[model samples]
Target: MLARVKLEKGCKSRGIKLSGALAAAGLIAAHSTKDLSDHQREKYAVVTLIDCRSILDPVLSSDYMGFYHSAILNTHDVSGGENLWDLAKRCYTAYSNAKNNNKHFTDMGDLNFLMCKAIENPGLTPSSSLRTAFISVFEDPVTDDTNEMHGEVGVEDYVGCSSVHGVGPSVAIFDTIRDGRLDCACVYPSPLHSRDQMQKLIDDMKKILVDGCANGESES
Candidate 1:
């Protein structure tokens, strides 16, 4: 159930496609009340932090990469009080890049833009099946309007999906950290690369998505 989306020229596009890690430098960053201390911050120092000022250049800015790097440099950044504009801009960039680069972009609409479009779709009911599907596919409650989903409410399981599927170089990097098969605990905090691990992730995800679709059809 990984959903990927892209943003371009202020427009957001969506795709039902595939589908993170890192350490912190501060002692507090290394270990949080909810996270583990086993992953060393030094392992993630390579991640870069995004600047808030990079919001204007949607086309060429590397903010999306910066956002992913920020996640690893300090996964704790999920709640570090960054501004909404910065996060939203980064999300837009990430989604756009993902759509352009990943094969998963086919047959998908942009969730970010679709939300507003839905609001204007008089022919569609908010409770209609299509609306529900659109929201389910792209409007991640775990990710805010800015589309950042790191430590957001009810979204620990989604961090991996959001990182890759959102838009940006982070998608590939997150997959690497996932190293593939993430257990339900979803505790691994860095990019994963083991062949066995990736195979497992892909298999598990395919099963989940396929079964969900079947169940939805049966219910209808």
Candidate 2:
């Protein structure tokens, strides 16, 4: 019986190709807006999956994401840190410093210090406006989101793949949002292995944003 089984051998199986899914997902993520002319406007629904319930009052109390409406305020002009990496580094430094010292570093002050230090380097006399812009990048939900799950999103979900590769979630959000979508830079897991996963993230984010807006409206 053993000899017969050996002779039969294992059946050869054709491996399913996931490259196509990955490629399609890449194209979706790479979608551009260069085609839109100056003054061209398109309606985009806002979405955010993180429960920003408390921060909502702080952000909404002001013109949170206010730069979107003004003519002069563009992505590069308003996203305080240089790139995703830079933002991540700043976040890490601030968090570490605060954790070690047991003293809270306010976001705005921490950002301003980061900006000053960034410009203090030789041959990097970037403008105060540029530094200020970096200091004003959008805030993330301070509440823990590692356990909540809605539409394939959990706390671990907000932590994007880049974070696994040593890239913090802040930077991922920075890079992703630079594409012009107001809702692009999110601090959440976005396993972009397939279009379906991407869509799930987007849908989940929209749900959160809608819910937050409703709550805000009701509170008012």
Candidate 3:
């Protein structure tokens, strides 16, 4: 998901993707309380989903769909106050390494086993809540706007979402771009994670993003 930079564009700069590690880093930093000692590092996990249609050996058309998205899990150790760009680079580096090694496919068996075990033994997850990861994002965003087909159906706008009240990450983000605007639908298990908590987390995330951009300072 770390797809912001194009080396060909001579962007000797770290990039952040809409559905990539940059988003995860922002969330992790937001979850870090100010009271946390600078020396303390918290471990956070994130999952990025990748569509296999274009990546398949024999690439298939987008119309041909059958649960083709695969996931790559990454764990980051955050000690708070880390530079956003540096953290983003680190997150991307880990994901890229794993993808290069084909961990998505190779780790499927183990992932399934762990999933089954988590279902059987809720204690395997946080608070025995079946919480597998902190966040889940897609590697790429789906882009579109209502077209002639939609005009016939009288569809002005639409959104895609799913029920994550069962076993899943704390936040599942489905991002899309329409008419050049990025929009995301987020789902989380309620009661388990109260609305206030998630709202505060999101507010803090926005602050972090705004501050990062406003300051315009990062590790070189």
Candidate 4:
């Protein structure tokens, strides 16, 4: 929670959001791994999901409630060692610029067309291989004061629920905050991925966030 708060403040100072910061950190950590060669790193396409409800028209906003987000694919080179703050700024700025230009809505028709073509001709699709995608959802953390049950029930005991399927991407991160703590669940294509490696990746992500927050504080 402390790390999240510090990151939020740091993002606010730079006109970005916490999700963007997380995306930046994750991208850096992902590419920094020694196992991945420069060629492999260059081939990575990091996609950042953005919610578009606020930018839609009032009628469309009220009518649609399902899958209204678009992805901002970052194809820029992240080869060299770069400052987290600068990376975050770039990521946020790209998304911000896209939103400001209404690309989310404007590009919908093209995306639909491409999807139809891909469905008709699977070969036209770039790759069938699945890659891990990172997602972060920072909700208001559950606390005693916010608990509707008051002292009658222990809010800390509550656990969120989710459903996963075998298809789709190889791995995805579902992050949420509860009781002032970050809870991240990595959903992977079971049996295909090593449990130890996935756990280490999660641990590395956490360390990156914590270190980024600490460094931000020291710099401030």
- Per-model lDDT: 0.29, 0.28, 0.69, 0.59
- RMSD after CA superposition, every candidate: 21.0, 20.7, 4.1, 4.6
Measured by TM-score, how close is model 2 to the native structure?
Answer: 0.23
Candidate 4, 2-73: lDDT as tens digits: 766776788888887765666666667767755655555443444555556656666355235475567554
lDDT by residue (tens digit), candidate 2, 1-220: 3321211121001121111111112222222212544344332111111223334434543324323211011121112112222222333343334434533323436544654565564234332222222111222312222243443553233332122321112112322221122223333333423456545645543443344334434543
TM-score rank order: 3, 4, 2, 1
lDDT of 2 at 78: 11
Worst 10 residues of 1 by lDDT: 18-27
* Index of the highest-lDDT prediction: 3
Error of 2 at 210 (Å): 1.6
Q: In candidate 2, where is summed lDDT lowest over 10 consecutive residues?
A: 69-78
Q: Tell me the spans in candidate 2 whose CA falls farther than 4 Å from its real position.
A: 1-171, 175-193
Off by over 4 Å in 1: 1-55, 58-193
Tens digits of per-residue lDDT, candidate 3, 1-220, equal 1122221111134454555433544555555844787677878888888788988989988768577878888988888667655576676777778988999899988887888889899998988989898888887777766555787999876788665345678878787765655566777787788888877776676566545544443322
Ranking by lDDT: 3, 4, 1, 2
Between candidates 1 and 2, the lDDT winner: 1
Question: How do the residues 1-220 of candidate 1 rate in per-residue lDDT, one tens digit apiece?
Answer: 2222111111222222222111111112222223444343321112222222333345445335533211112112223322222333343344445444532233234433554555566246333322212111121112223323434655444453433222122112222223223222222213433555544544444343344334434543
lDDT of 2 at 84: 23
- lDDT over C-alpha atoms for residue 130 of model 2: 22
Candidate 3 colliding pairs: none
TM-score for predicted model 3 compared with the true structure: 0.82
